[model samples]
Target: MTRPLRVVAAMSGGVDSAVAAARAKEAGHDVTGVHLALSRNPASYRTGARGCCTIEDANDARRAADVIGIPFYVWDLSDRFHEDVVEDFMGEYAAGRTPNPCLRCNEKIKFAAVLDRALALGFDAVATGHYARLRTGDDGLVELHRAIDGGKDQSYVLGVLDQAQLRHSLFPLGDTPKPEVRREAAARGLLVADKPDSHDICFVADGDNAGWLREKLGDRAPNQGGAIVDESGEVLGRHQGTYAFTIGQRKGLRLGRPAPDGRPRFVLDIEPVSGTVTVGPREHLAVDGLTGIRPRWCGTVPGTLDGPGVTVQLRAHGEEHRAVVRVTGEKSAQTVEIDLLDPAYGIAPGQAAVVYDGGRVVGSATISATRRAAVSAR
Candidate 1:
């Protein structure tokens, strides 16, 4: 028999969240539905099922709570979201790095801010629809794991959660598939059962990330225009802004002339200060290792790891790479060094490297530097 708990359901007004809230209630827990108001001007975000934290989504959440027969409320975290997620996103781009805002939101907003408030309000736990699983490890600590539905597993983004956050978190949809979740939602009379999943960056309504950055970054942009150079230091083209490009970007280079060999060129490096975008062959983009900073462990942090079971995910929904991970420095200054057994291409700094021990999530870190593969293009 399971003990009933007073849970706060972080409803995003989507099918998964609504279903999660209902399931928490059905499990004999005292559940309260709360929708996070992330944007101050919700109208600026996407309106339909393609967006999240919008005005329509809030209304949908309220209606879902009604159907679930639970008390509902909305919490305004707009300022926090803007500072921690939005501002950080702009900063990362301006610094010539590709960051995952969804991962940051999970770390800073969803789990940190919301969970803190829930605990202060006397809630025993916070429930959400994130497709990840929680399990008791041999050491008796809670471990984060990949969901049964691999296609929908979100453990990579959630790798930021620490031991305390995992303790009071509940993912009710981990064992079920997406189709089953929607079907269950319909059976529960939830109106958002068939709503399409939100895609792209929610704040970027038009899905034009570069254009949006240009509009918002105004004075903060590194340069209005800069030279695009090749390996030989030849100025191949010019770019409007360094923020518009990322490492491994293949298309949109619009180089005035093709390479002498006629092979395709890819963005190999970006120097924000100099506003220099470096283009090269695809083979030059391979990286054999990376150093990650600000490592966030799900449970206890390991000092050193070198085993066949150890794997690392460099991007969300990306395939894992066998790695030898080493933890260095103390607490706040700690860094993770990962040596990938297989060279990976298009890996960028500011991306997260979620380390896993088989199906269990050990931790995650923000990639700060990478060591290029020694091999040259044939």
Candidate 2:
């Protein structure tokens, strides 16, 4: 006989999450719902089908919990969220690194802080509406897999989850499609069934990160005008701020001059100390090798690959590429040397590199440096 697991569902007041919480109950888990108040100001939530972390979201989560017949509570995590996510976000940008706020939230807040709180409070596991599947392997290890709906798969955001977090986490909507989850929510009489998904960062009120940082960081937002240079150290133009540019960005470079070959220019590197944003032809963006630091593995320590056997995902919605990865660092400060079978463009530092073996998540790490193919200036 299976014992009923005591679970805490992290409700986000969205259709998918509402359905996930209900599914937890259906699975015979002794479930309770909790809404995280990530914003200090309750009314800061954008009006009409936009934004997250609003008082309305908390209320909707409570209502969903009512429909699920589970006890619900709203926890004020605004301070912690600001310190861990918002500040880290600004800090990364200030240091000339592009950081993914969602990935940080999942790693620090959702899985680490919330999961820890749940276990301390006697709950066995923390459940959410993330679109990722879990399977128990023959070795009794829980493996993370891509969701059934490839379009809605959230494994990219969830690749930050370590083995401990994966062990105590639940994702009920992984095997279900997004539409089916919405239908389940409607069938269960949850009002959030039709609530629009919050696609923007929860704390960013206007969805303009650059603008928001300017207001918050004030003179510290890296908005100082900087020189735009080419690989040969030739000054091509000037930019308002290095933060405004990312690797592979071309459109907004506003470079009055074009390359000698009349080809487009792309951002190749960013040097914050010197306030320089480097640009080059599109070919210069190609990087054949990458070294990743600050690593996290799902299960086993990575072994050498003889061929392009492993898959590497560089961006959230980006295509997976075949690569050969070699692990080369110690336990806590782990690193990996990845040799892409094909040239990967726009690979940047501070961006996470998630590895997979087929559909299962193998591990993840932060990109530290790149081995770019040299390009002759035209």
Candidate 3:
């Protein structure tokens, strides 16, 4: 609520985070920079200064802290990250679901685990370089908002933040444009000023998820051995495993039977138990509605959201769709049902379905299941 508050700047050894910590310090906050060592072996995580989990990143973070004239420390969060984010990622894929590790990290790591530790250590808040804004809502409470720059709006990824996390978080890059942040980093003499932006999944350093999963899971990997099937339970071909297929994935099916229209077939379903990968035309991926498990509301979910005002975001950088959410059940069984106004494709399970009320993120939920709109491939 005031400047000069004790804050921990979570530096990622990139220009954005470097500039973020610098901004927090410049604003008179007693900022202490901390770099999270998220890999079991830093050297083998991701080579070069291009990735967040690399040793170069840690060094860059320390260098940034030096330039900012603040104390910096490297915290080993590898164990927690492995348990919460990495393990969960493998588990989801094993179950024929696609999980967003970034969202998981935001929910379980940066905000939950790290915030708990920071609070216990007497830090008022954790500041990051995420492109998001915090403003007092019409209800007079702090609320998360999309960044002013629509292109860099990371509200979708940060949609996992709940009321408590939002209150104790600061995003200094919220109002600053991407280019401006780089310029600021350059002006401040931060060593990471020219570092490349990290992309893909940080933990999956090589970007080869299938190969990585195979190595990690061994015999348990989904693509290790499976059969390719059709909608009617007819086996079309043989496959290595089913985890390699996701909803709306058409390119890698390698199916011989093409539709009458000669259009390529797409992966429609993944039956992990049967070790069966279902293939169908693109229309089969259309979903009527989705049920999200473990809903995390950003602020508060109104009691009665009967129709169409609810906006459902299925991907981190995808378009929002109109829907209606009904908060059902209670406790661990709590879930939300979203009925889309128009059918959407690629509604994969285990992916997050973040809900929004206007420009503000109202809440988010992990898609546990989807009710597909029936389609006849013949």
Candidate 4:
């Protein structure tokens, strides 16, 4: 029998988290529920069911803890959230790259900060509702893998975690599907059972990335307006800001003119300093290789980078691409070079390229550069 552990459950006022905490308690673990206060003024954050880490979410989490018969407390991590996740996000956009803030939050806040605090407070592990499976490998190392429910697998974001973090983390709801979790939440008398799943960037409030960036960046924004150019250096249109566009974006270009070949155009590149937004045919967005920096390994550091059967995931919900990975540099300067056997479209810098050996997560790296597929525009 496994020993009972003192676990801190991170309740996000969502059905999954509530059910996870309840399951942990049921498993004979000493569990305490804690809600993260991510927003300085939660009032300005999203209300209703749209986004999480709001004032309403904290209350909901407290209520769920009450029902689960566990002690609950709110940890004020607004300052950390702002500096790590929020600021990093703004800075990435300003640098003309697309970063996954969720990945950063998991790396810096949830695992790094929260796990550090939990260990300091005598907790054996910090449990969350993340849908990723953990198992002890033959080498006695803990491995992170995809959840049984493929549709809800979140191992991609969690690929940032290292061996120590995985050892001290618990995900009780990984094997169960989302529907079963909701039903279990209802059975446990948790009020958040019917709460809608949070969507988009939690801090973005409204879904308008451009408008929100414009407001936050203010005078600090690169340019109020810039020229949108095609691959041939022909100016297609003007955009309010380069931060407003991302690679592979087809909508909202407002180009006002179609391509010479009458083909729909997509954003090809973003140059923040020059305030240049490049647009071209969709074929131009295909990338065959990428250079990834800041590699974070989950378990054993892979020695054979050119081995077969390696796959990489570039987006949160994106499909896996078979690739050959090579590691270069040393320590903090180490970078990964991936040659994708299957070309991916619109892959952008600052995005995470999660490496997976089958279902098990090996590690992840931040995409720094991409090699576009050879193609000539019409």
List TM-score per model, in order: 0.98, 0.94, 0.94, 0.97
Each model's lDDT: 0.92, 0.85, 0.84, 0.91
Task: Quote model 4's TM-score.
Answer: 0.97
- Scored by Cα lDDT, where does model 1 land? 0.92
| lDDT string, candidate 3, 236-330, tens digits | 78876666767778776776777657777888888888788888778888998998888888877655464545688898888888888788787
68-177 in candidate 1: lDDT tens per residue? 99999999999999999999999999999999999999999999999999999999999999999999888899999999999999999999999999999999999999
Model 3 clash pairs are: 223-240, 223-241, 224-240, 225-240
Query: lDDT tens digits, residues 1-378, model 4?
Result: 589999999999888889989999999999999999988877644655566788778889999999999999999999999999988988888889999999999999999899999999999999999999999999999999999999999999999999999999999989999999998888888888888999889887667788888888878877777899988888878888888999999999998888877889999999998899999889989999999999999987775565566899999999999998888788769989999999999999999999998899999999999999888645
For TM-score, candidate 1 versus 3, the one ahead is 1
Model 1 TM-score? 0.98
Q: Give, for candidate 3, the lowest lDDT window spanning 10 residues.
A: 43-52
lDDT of 4 at 260: 71
- Which regions of candidate 2 are displaced past 4 Å? 47-50, 221-223, 306-309, 374-378
Q: What is the lDDT of residue 270 in candidate 1?
A: 95
RMSD of 1: 1.2
Looking at candidate 3, what is the lDDT of residue 171? 95
